[model samples]
Target chain A: SAVISQKPSRDICQRGTSLTIQCQVDSQVTMMFWYRQQPGQSLTLIATANQGSEATYESGFVIDKFPISRPNLTFSTLTVSNMSPEDSSIYLCSFSGDGKQDTQYFGPGTRLTVL
Target chain B: AQTVTQSQPEMSVQEAETVTLSCTYDTSESDYYLFWYKQPPSRQMILVIRQEAYKQQNATENRFSVNFQKAAKSFSLKISDSQLGDAAMYFCAYRSRRGSNYKLTFGKGTLLTVNP
Candidate 1:
């Protein structure tokens, strides 16, 4: 399993402000996924980030609001734009192991609190 | 659309005792994967066990095991000899085995409390 790390474990931001979270995996991976977990709720797939290509966002997610960047195989960034209180959630990044083992490991997660 | 359901919102067990977390999912696909992930206070999702839909045998890891009934669409996790460390939010996830669809559908989660 690749060791995953996310920057700014948590943050408190004001409404209308934007925050970018960084996810870095110890090893190179082909596919990286971003998920958002609202307080006391389950995880929802925000988008899929693949290196050298634009991300694929879910139905409710948009590139303009939740932009993703996959500069390399091991690193990706997710930025929440024009954030509101409803955007407060824990964001996680995960990747499957070479897409063979049928498993996905996740990062520690970035907890964002919008006021 | 695949949907995973965790009926119990919370569960408790005494140390060294046993506990079971229930999960059910609806999917038309025959070949898929089911997983149990634990998210502790630190919010790190840890894979506890996994069951391939094609396999009849249940999946187990240490004291954590799953009773998978494909016909009933039920995948329940049984934790024997439960420890305080086992306390966390358990989420049931479903993934398709077919083509580039590797995204997971997760349940709301059940918060487990292990009391010593």
Candidate 2:
């Protein structure tokens, strides 16, 4: 398993604001994923971030709303744009290595609260 | 598409006792993977156990074990000698082994409470 960390741990933002959550992994991984867990809800895949290529968003997620950046194998960022109360949720990042593609290790998660 | 379901919204167990959490999934593919992830109040997703669909034997990790019934599409986690640290939100996840379908589908989660 890889050691993963997220920046800011948590944050509170006002409506219409934007916040960027950074996910850093200890080792290089092939695929990085971003997931959103809304209040009392299950985890939802936001997108899949692959190094050197544009991210692939899941259904109901768009580039304009949740922009992702995979600058390298071990780093990725997910920015929540035009935030509202409905956007408040815990955002998490996970990664799967070459030999361990079936399993994914997760970060601590960034807890966002919109006011 | 795959869907994971955690039927129990909440479960309680006395400390040092055993408890079982139920999970069932719907998937057309035969080869797939199921996982039990624990999220404490800290909100970090921790992998508790994993079971590969092809394997017949169940997976065991110390006191944590899974009962995987491939035909029944049922996967359940049994915790022995439960402790305070064991109380958390348990989520059942399913992933397809097919190519290009690497996303995980998670259940709504079962909040486990360890009563002292």
Candidate 3:
């Protein structure tokens, strides 16, 4: 089990502004994942970040809009660029040791509201 | 492609009683993993229980257990001695055995309201 934390617990930003959320882990993990969850909706995978490699984004998400950086095995950042009302959601970061399926855990989400 | 479904949107149960949350998934892969997550008002996704496709013995933790049927593609979470703290949004997830499938396919989620 890994303990993860995200910076900027909550933020209210005006449209067109960008916010970068950082995720730090207690231990070095092999895989870091980012997810977005709209109010009262299920989670949607944004991208998979691995150290020293470009993040693999899922369909309907682009690097220009949601750029992710995994500088090392224990840290990563996700930047929400040119935010809009549609981007108002809870951003979550998760990590797993050895890239296993069950040892994975999630960090407390960063709630963002684009006004 | 894989899909997870949680037919029940919301369920109410009395405290100290048992409650079951249903989950069904569609996948072509034979080897996979199923998980149940709980998200309370805090919005932190917590892993409640998980089951491997190859393992038939149900996985149990304290008061949380799962009934996984591989041929039926069903994984349900049963919470016993439910407490008010157990009230939360429950999600069902599926993952393939392949290492490349890092992302999980999640269900619509079930809101469990534990009434006093």
Candidate 4:
């Protein structure tokens, strides 16, 4: 199991403003992922952040709205761009040990409230 | 695409009693993994149990255990000697072992309440 820490545990922002959430892992990992959990809803995959490359966005999500950055294996960030009321949700960062392991360890999650 | 389903939206169990949460997944691939995660009021996600598809034996961690039925594509979590601390939202997840993509498909989740 890996220890994942996310910054700015909770934040409140204006509707038009954007917020970037950071995720840091205690140890280096190969793959990192981002997910969104709306109020009273299940989690949905947002994208896969690859080190030194563009993030892979899932269906129904666009890179323009959710830009991701992964400069190294142990760290990644997800920026919620052009936020709206609908963008209010809990953002989580997850990672796996390697290809051999299938379970993911999740961060504490960043709670964003868009007003 | 792989998908996980948790039919029970809500469940209640008395303290010290046992409870079972049902989960089923759909995947064409033979090799995969299933997981159960718990999210309490604090909102922190905690891994409860995990099962490997290739392994025939069920996985158990103290009071938490899994009933992995590979042939039936069913994986249920059994919480024995439930306590107030066990009250939380439980999510069933699936991951494809063969793909380079390290994404997990999560179920809708089941809210578990334990009453003393």
Best by DockQ: 2
Question: Which has the better DockQ: candidate 2, or candidate 3?
Answer: 2
- Give the alpha carbon lDDT tens digit for every residue of A1-115 in model 4: 5689999899999998889999999888888999999999999999988898889999999988898999999999999998899999999998877443467888999999999
Better of 3 and 4 by TM-score: 3
Mind giving the per-residue lDDT tens digits that candidate 4 earns over B1-116?
A: 88899999999999999999999999999998899999998888888998999999999999999999998999999999999999999999998888586678999999999999
Cα lDDT over the full model 3: 0.93
Backbone clashes in model 1, listed as residue pairs: none
Clashes of 2: 0
Q: Score residue A39 of candidate 2 by CA lDDT.
A: 94
The DockQ-based order of candidates, best leading, equals 2, 1, 3, 4
Candidate order by decreasing TM-score: 2, 1, 3, 4
Candidate 4 global CA lDDT score: 0.92
lDDT per residue, candidate 1, B1-116, as tens digits?
99999999999999999999999999999999999999999999999999999999999899999999999999999999999999999999999999988899999999999999
lDDT of 2 at B26: 97
Interface RMSD of 2: 0.4
lDDT values for all models: 0.95, 0.95, 0.93, 0.92
Candidate 1 Cα outliers beyond 4 Å, as residue runs: A98-101
User: Which residue pairs in candidate 4 collide?
Assistant: none
Considering TM-score, which of the candidate structures 1 and 4 is the better prediction for this target? Answer: 1
Every prediction's TM-score for the first chain?
Answer: 0.96, 0.97, 0.95, 0.95
Clashes of 3: 0
Q: Please report, as a residue range, the 10-residue window in candidate 3 chain B with the lowest summed lDDT.
A: B95-104
